[model samples]
Every structure is written in C-alpha cells, then in structure tokens.
Target: MNSKSEALAAAKKRITDLQSQMTAKILAIAAEVEKLMDVTPEREVRDFLRVTCNLPSSELGTYMGFGRTLKGSEALLQKARVTFPVLKALVAADAETRQEIVERMDIGARIDTKEIAVVRKRLTEAKLTPEALMAQKNVRLVAAAARKRSADTAALFREKLASFALHLRKMNASDLALASLSETVRNDALELREQFTDIFGTSRRSLNKINLNSPAFRVAAANDALKRICEGRFGNSSHYAGVKKWPASDSQIIDVLLLLSGHPVPRRGWVRGRNAITELPPHRYRLKAIELCAGAGGMSIGLERAGFEHVALFEYNADAAATLRQNRPDWNVVEADITKVDFKPYRRMDIDLVAGGVPCQPYSSEGDQLGQEDERDLLLESSRVIAEVKPKMFIIENVEGLLHAKHGDHVAEFLRRVAKAGYQTEINRIRAEDYGVAQERHRILLIGIRRELAGSFRMPPRFPERRSNLGDALLDLMSENGWTGAREWARQRRDCPVFDRQGNLIAHGVLASTVVTRRGTPRTKEAARWGSKGINIGGLPAAAPTDAEASKPGYLPGLTARMRARLQNFPDDWKFHGGKQSVADQIGNAVPARLAQAVGLAAFAAIRGVSFDWEAMLWPGDRGRLQMTTPALYLDQPQLAPGRKKPEQNVRTVESAGDW
Candidate 1:
C-alpha cells in the first residue's frame, strides 16, 4: 500500500510538471511569434503555427493572446481556457479586470459557453477599456433587455395593424362612394387620407392587373385596400371550370372587403421569430466576412445570425442597397458592381469568408439559357473578386437551374477556375424549405475553401425534416389591428396548398410564393409599371419587358412585399426600402436568411473544425440555449416543400412545380 501511494504521488507530480512545461512551451512559441514582428511576421508566424502546432490563421491570434496573459500578472489565463471567447475578451482586458471577469462568469449571470462566445466577440469589436467594461457589465445588461423587450413586439404589431386598417379604409373610399362606406369606416378613412396627403401630397387610388391608372402616387395604398378586401376569399378567377359557384358583384365584393378589413387585431400577417435572434448585442460571432450582391441584406443578416462580423457588403441595386445601408448604418456598404470594385484593399484584411448571390438570368431556364454567352453573366467577375480578396473561404448562391445549366458546364467551369485560384470547391443543391423557409426554394450553394484548409470543411447539414408552413410564418404579422377575419384567413391560407406548374404539391399552409426580384413578383399592373425601369444589360433581353399584367403568365394573390420578406426569413425590424413591386423584387431575389445561417455556420465550423448537432440545433432546451440556428420548420405536422423559378420557361423537356 505504501508503494502504491508512492507511485500515485509520482504520477501526479509528473502530470503537474508536464502541464507547466506545456504552458511554458506555448508561451515561448507565442513570444517568438511576437518577436518576429519586424520580419515577414504574419505569414511566417501563421505558417509555423499552422504547420507545426496545427492552428489555423483564424485561431492564431487567439493563442497569441493566451501567451500575453501568461506573461502578464494574475490574469487567470488558464481558467479562461474553459471558454475561449472569455479567454479572448479577458486577454484584451487589463490584468485586474480580466480576473474580475473570470470570477464574475463563475458567480454572476452564470453565462454559458455560447453566451460567452457572443459577449466576447461583441466586446472585442467594441474594444472597450477596462473601465468601460465594468460600467457595461460587458453587454449582458443589453441582452437581458432584448429578451424582455422582444415580448412587446406583439403589442407593437397590433398598433401597426390598426394604423394599416385606417389607411386601407381610406384608400377604399378613393374609388367607391364614401357614403357607401360604414360611418366608422368613412371617418377612419378620412383621417388616414389626411395623414397620407400630409405625408405624400396625394389621395390614394385603386389598382389591379387590369387597371390603367397604375403607378400613381398611391399605388401601394390602392393595392393594399384591394388586397385586404379580396385576399383569403380565394376567388382570383383561376378556379376549375367544372365547379359552379356564386360570384359576388362589385358592390357586394366591396362590402366583404370592408367587413374583413375591420375584423380583428391581427389585420395582416404578423411574424416575430418565435425562436430567433431578432437583433445582435447578445449574439455576435468572432469571424469576419464580406458579401456581394447583398440584396436587401438577406444573406448578410443570416451570416450575422451565425456569428460573423461583416466587413463590407457590395451591392449595385440602388433601392435594395438603400435598405441595407439604412438599416445597418454602421456596416460598410459599397454601392458598385462586382467588376467595378477593386478588391486589392481587402486582400490583407484576413477576412474569413466572402458570400455572393450572383444574377442568374443568363443561366435560368426561363430566359435564353445563354450561360457564358450572356454579357451580364458575372461568373468571371465573381471569380476575379474572389481571387483578389483571397479569403479563407467563400460561398456562392444561385438558382438551382445553374446546376443543370449549359448542360451543367457553367457550374463545372466556374469550379475549375476557382480551383485554379487555390481553392478546393464543392457544390450542393439545397432546398430552402428544408431549412425552415416557408417557400420551397432550391438553390445551388458552391462552397470554396482555401486548399490548405479543405480537410476541415464539412458538408453543411441538411434540414429535410424542417417544415415551416405559410400560416405559421405570417399569422402574427397578419393579426394586427384586431381584424375579425384573420383566423379564418389563416384557416383558408392553410387550406390553400401551393402547387407548381406540374400540378405537384410543393409546400402547404404557407403565406407566400418565393420572393423573386421585382421582375418575377406577381404585382398588379400599376405596381409593376411603377417599379419597372425597362433596361437590359450586355445585350440581354430587358429583365422587365412590356407585359400583359391581367394575364400575368401565372398569378397568385395574397403575397405582399412585407409578407414576401418574412418568407425570405427577414426579421420584423428589418425594413425593405422602395416601392411595392421593387421591394417585392428585392425580397424575392434574396437568399432566405434562415438558410444562409446554415451555410455561414458550416463555413465557420470548417474554420473551427467542429461538427454541429443538427437535431439539437433544431430543438433546444433553454430559452437562451439557441442564438441563431435554423428555425423550426414544422409547427404541427410535416409538409412537402416546393421550389420556384421563373415562368415555366416554355420547357418542352422539363417543367416548373407551380402553374399559373
């Protein structure tokens, strides 16, 4: 027994001595890395760490912080190791503050690793002094406030819906008899009209596919009234011929519209992510990124949810760019085409990733399928920027037809070029509904990692079990201002299963078709005329050619710009700037933010060499357990999701899922 005890004691001593030795060795290497500041510093140190110690560039700076703490006084650097984010922040703090933060983590708020990661990243970005850190509680106070305030979103939504009803009623009277409207409705409409004239200097008008007086000063106002009156009635003149039904006269239809408008508090669809990171502060990531073709900032928002810090977002569309710039003023938004921008400035930023949703008209089956022949085809330009930026990774999003475009050579050709630029690339066709989007949007996601880090990349997890229907996605958004017919509207919307042109069920109980750019959205003639600029690029056909709106090859009602953005996974607070059709087009063109989070998380995980638990992510146990993961797709039952593209493309060989 004495000999056994002696052996155990020796073993413990040896472990203790080795731990000290390991810490000392790491400290020594870190010191050497620092000392080489005058000589090819970043490259030499990054290479040594990557090749010898197996640390990627993204993590190299973190270890350097650890070494600095060990050399400094009483900072508890080793304890900080339990949470790397805390370690990261603690290292940045002064010695006394660092120790205080470590102790506070153990006692106060009892923050977990995930929260710590978020807090640390935010603190790092803020770069607060130790004194500021103490006063701010390192932003935990802000997180608590967000959680409390999010509850008020429902009340706010109600207020907005009430205001919406007043406007709709006023717009309804513009074309019909004010005396014909109910006394309560006419009074409310009058007040709203005054407010409208006060804001825009004009009275509202009525509009639809057959209307000629469209694109006036109040097209949104007119269409909104018509939409509220006509929506959920399920009578858009597209029913089967075999069914004999009673049709409402114009006056009777107007009465039903007014009655439905005044029904309940939830007047329009209301959506606040039942489980989503509605804002930042409590959940920010440590990595850096840049986005191209950032329409309405959809992917940018998603990447933010996944914990990335956007360095810049490049977009050429004036209105869509305005929305991004207005909402995220702090972000660096570069308004320019990919070819016009010089990427030399970003070459040394150590950006971890770059994302883009290049225009797909050239490759889409709807148009000429011209592929490389189209002048607007931006594949080469996208590749050039990638080469110049030379980030550790990149993700390119486009319509799924690109997977089968130019007999599939378009994607293959781009892959070869990116490979030549020193990247190991892989492509996958992902269905957006699988990731909780109400619309079944199938997109081709091309992920490219620097060849050296290729081994770390993992195939992004698929969410086939996700089943978000339109009713759940937009119910709360619609339930504003106490509209009485809202519940019934929801019931009918669910009954309205979305089918593709092939007469196949794609998604059930959803509120919108996929958000397409303005040209593809189902806008009434007036709204379309107001939004269309009628210009083509590189000799390609005009994106919005002169069209017959009343017979819009295929038309579906109940999809508004606001609802379209919701279906595209935009948060309620995020606003889209521009006219009705322009906004709709922007929403449609965007990659659903919910789906983008998956790609962002995948790219981030590759850098960190971590595997995600998809099941756990989809189903969480604690309130703060999840920050930005894919939202639950199914509220009650599983439903099939359908993908959408431009009109049937007159395809003799292939067909779209939806029919007009």
Candidate 2:
C-alpha cells in the first residue's frame, strides 16, 4: 500500500474510535445521572456535567438527552446519536415507528447521518404526528420569542399611554353605521388625566403604574378598553352599539366600523376591480421591498402593482417558489427555510419596505388559538428579520382573532415590541368587502413606519362601497371550460338578493364563502370507503340525482378552483401549478391579491409622504364618494400630545385630506 493510502486509513480509524469512545463516555455519565436521582431532571444533570466534566451548559442537553434515551448502552445510542441527534424527536415517535426507523437504518454498516436524516424528514412530513411536531415546535418558539428585558414593560406603558392620550384627544363627533363617536366620549388633552381617572377607574397617571409588562395586566387592560369601545362603554360614558354575542376577540371591529365610518356604501351594483389590484397614478419613485413568506407571490404581486420594486422574495414552499418563478422570473426568489436564511447579507441594500402575510394559525380563531404561546407563531421571527433589514416601513397582516387572543396579550406584546424597536405602528381591522375583494374575510393589518417618518404616516381608511358579487368574481372562470350552467348560476345568484346587500354574495354565488385552503369535500380515505373514483369539487352546482336520472355527473354546480382563485383576486392570466386540490390549497392560503394591493398603497403613501386619495383610483363605479364627511377618529401628528415633538415632515407630504 502507498504511504498516502496508509495514512488516510489510519486517520479514518482514529475518527471512528474517538466517536465511539465519546458516545460511550456520554452514555456512562447519563446512566450515572439516571441511577443517582430517581427523579433528577435533565437540567440538574446538565448543571452537574457543567461542573464535573467541564462541559458547556449549552451542550449538556445533548449528552443528557442521549443518556435519557439509552443510559449506558453505547452501541445503541452511539449509532442513533449520529443518525438523529435530537433525542426528543426520536422519543416523540410511537415505539413502533421508532423501532421501524431503527430497523430500516440497520442496513448500513455505519450510521449515515445524511441518509437517516432524509428518512426521518419523510416520515415526519407524511405522518406529522402532533407529538413530534410539537417537540420541534416548542424549541422553535423559544428561539423566536423576543428576549424579555427589564425595559419591555416600560416601553409597553409609554406606548399605551401615548396611544390613549392621542385617542382621547381625537375621539369626537363621527357618524358610523353602528354608532357615532360623540362629544361625550371625547376629552380635552389637558382634562384627560382627571377624566380618565374618573372614568376607566385608572387615571392616565395610574395606567403607567399597572405593570404593563405583566401578561395578566396587559391582557385585562386591552380587553377592558376594546370591550368598552366596541360596546360603546368608553370614558365611563355610553353611546356604544350593544352588539350581543360571545365575547369575540375582534368585537372591537364594531368600533373600527365607527371610528373611520365613511360615506354611505353603494349597495346595488357590483364593486368594480374586485379581482384586480386598483392601479394608482404612476408615481415617479419606485420604492424597494423584501417580501417574507412570499407565498405564491400574492403580496409581492400586489406590491408590484403598488409601484414597489421587489429586491428579493423569501418563501419556503417549493410549489410557491415555482409559482413566483413562473409568474415573475425577474424576481429574485429565495427558496429557503426562513429560520436558517441569513438576513445579514441584505442589510446593505436600501430596502424601503418589508411586507408579509405571516402564518395565522397560531393566532387564528379556527385553530388552538395559542397566540404567542404557539411555536408556529411567526410574528417574532418577522420582527427579527425586520430588525435585521431595518426597512423604512413594514406592513404585516394577520387574523383578526389576534387582537382577542390570550385576552389581547399577543397583540399588546407585538405593539410593545414594535414601539421599543423605534417604530410607530398603526393597526387597522379591515373587512375585505370594503377593499375590493368579494369575501367579507376580516384581517388585521399592522403598518409600522420608522420613527423618523412616522409623523407623516397615517392609516388609509376604508372605502365604503361594496364590490362585485361572487357571481362577478367567478363568472368568467366557470365559463372558461364551457360549462353550460355557468351563466345560469351567475344569473340566478346575481339576481336574487341574499343576506349580503352588496359585494360578493354571502351565501349563494353572491359571494362565495371564504375561499379557504381546505375544500369542504370528502377526504381520500372517506372517498375510498364510498367506492368513488376521482371525485371532482367546485365545478357548477350538483343537485341530487332524481329517479329519472336527470342529475348526471358534472350536472350539479360547484365552486371550482379557478373560480375560488378569482374570488381571491388572483388574475385569470396567472395560473396555479398544483392540480385541482393543490390549486384549491394555494388559493385558500393566499392573501387576496387585491386586499394586499390596497395595503401596499397605504405603505406607498406612507413612505412617499402623500395623501392616499388612492381610494379614488378604484374601479370607476366602485370608488363611490371617496370622502369622509364626518370627523374621523384618526389623529394626525398635530393632534397628538404637544409634549412629544413631531418628526420632520417629508417634502412629499401632502396638505390635503388629512382626515385619512
């Protein structure tokens, strides 16, 4: 044998022997820990190892976990450790599943971590056992959470105090569909301290004392304040629209309808541009944006319409990445797991906006409603990326239930964090109906402006007109396949008025139900049991077959994938690559492109310091009197407490329509 070959073999043997020895030593320590204390927690052993073995505390969990898994069984743990380093991941699987994985990997002479990792990933993805998912989920949650510091509560108090002080001063006569904000609710800035004390039982002075950092305190305060505003119980006075229902997290939407209530909505006709982003006047400057969680390019597409040039699009889904590539090959689409992708590289770029519609399940009303408690909640991650990118502005969209989650704890934490990070945030609870989408899907939008430009930034208010019906949204798509019933379905649904007065039919085809990601049809297992082969969904209505055999297959009407996608404001020209069910999932998960467009316009105006009379840019018929005839509760920079100095106004700032 050559000298080089002999040296290589010798080195490889050294590595193999050392790895085995280390695994054996770790197993021995773990077994000792287990035997010494019948109930010793892994953390206690971690500390013991830190002192006894000079092991770093950060790495103790791995050795302790290895011990907990196999005690002193060196051969077993040494093999599995290389294959699946995460002990919790292995333990989370059912015993049968774990045994199966071990048996499968036993084929190899040595533990091939790469090969085992692939099998582990496939098994985890296909099974998605809640136990296994949650184990990883918990670790991620801690890593993503904003580190708590002593200053967090102080920042929370200052933010709330400032918001309250400004709101009390701005609350005045405003006509709304539900109720009017009258003089009784409004307070003089100077008188607010005394009045606040007499009213909400806490003086403005004492609001700072309530320990805003306390989760319990923050939740209770938000609940009380929102409840009062929605129920017309603000300032210890009464004018609240008494909405009788369960204490929903977003009942505050009732107050939102009042706060920015605009001219009467045009109800009879269709809202134009329901399926497209409203094109605004061509602006000179094209601001740059970095899109996070850029699924299917919904937000990115909308931002493109809003005149923002995309510098990069970050998305994890391969299918979604393909969709973005298919549509805009020019866009720099980065397909990567967000947690691992380093944002430090883009810090040098002059990014003007950071926008994304993050996962909502963590705070969604439909799920466990875990809010900040859920590891899946990505708001903290978004904030982390935002800090890294340090954009001039950011727009984040989430489920309305976020405002009500954990008694409003999650949202308060979010706002406090934003304020502490030196950004001024404005939240708007928007109903998609008012924004040119057919569905009444309600979402909360949080727009943050860097503190320097905040004085000139104001939330764009709702346009009061209703848009086109569901019939209008999908009429073209349903007919694309030459389905004979398409016209009749749209005709019958459009003509007969349903529960909703205007803007997509609520029940019938007026407005298709919220085009969700999941189809309300049989699952694969259920279909198999029913002896059906390849079932179709969402294509013309299907009526029950008569004994006469008139109701043939495809005769009944259903909402098709294309039609649902249209209702979600995706242009017909853009195609979803996933076949049928996959298409449905994409459509359901997308942020209505049109809704995102409006949000982007708001950001555009905020960054450019312009009055977003952009509402007037909606479809000719749909833009109905785009005016706020009554006083709007939204306060401009001037109306805020005088103690705080306003940031320098930008040259682009407009002097008109300040009410918005």
Clash count per candidate: 40, 19
Tens digits of per-residue lDDT, candidate 2, 360-468, equal: 8887655688877787678877877787777888899888776662524345456667767778777767777777677657888878888767666655567655556
Q: Identify the leading candidate in terms of lDDT.
A: 1
Score residue 351 of candidate 1 by CA lDDT. 73
Query: How well does each candidate superpose onto the true structure, as a TM-score?
Result: 0.45, 0.47
Worst 10 residues of 2 by lDDT: 627-636
lDDT digits (tens) for residues 362-402 of candidate 1:
77655677777888788777888888888889999887666
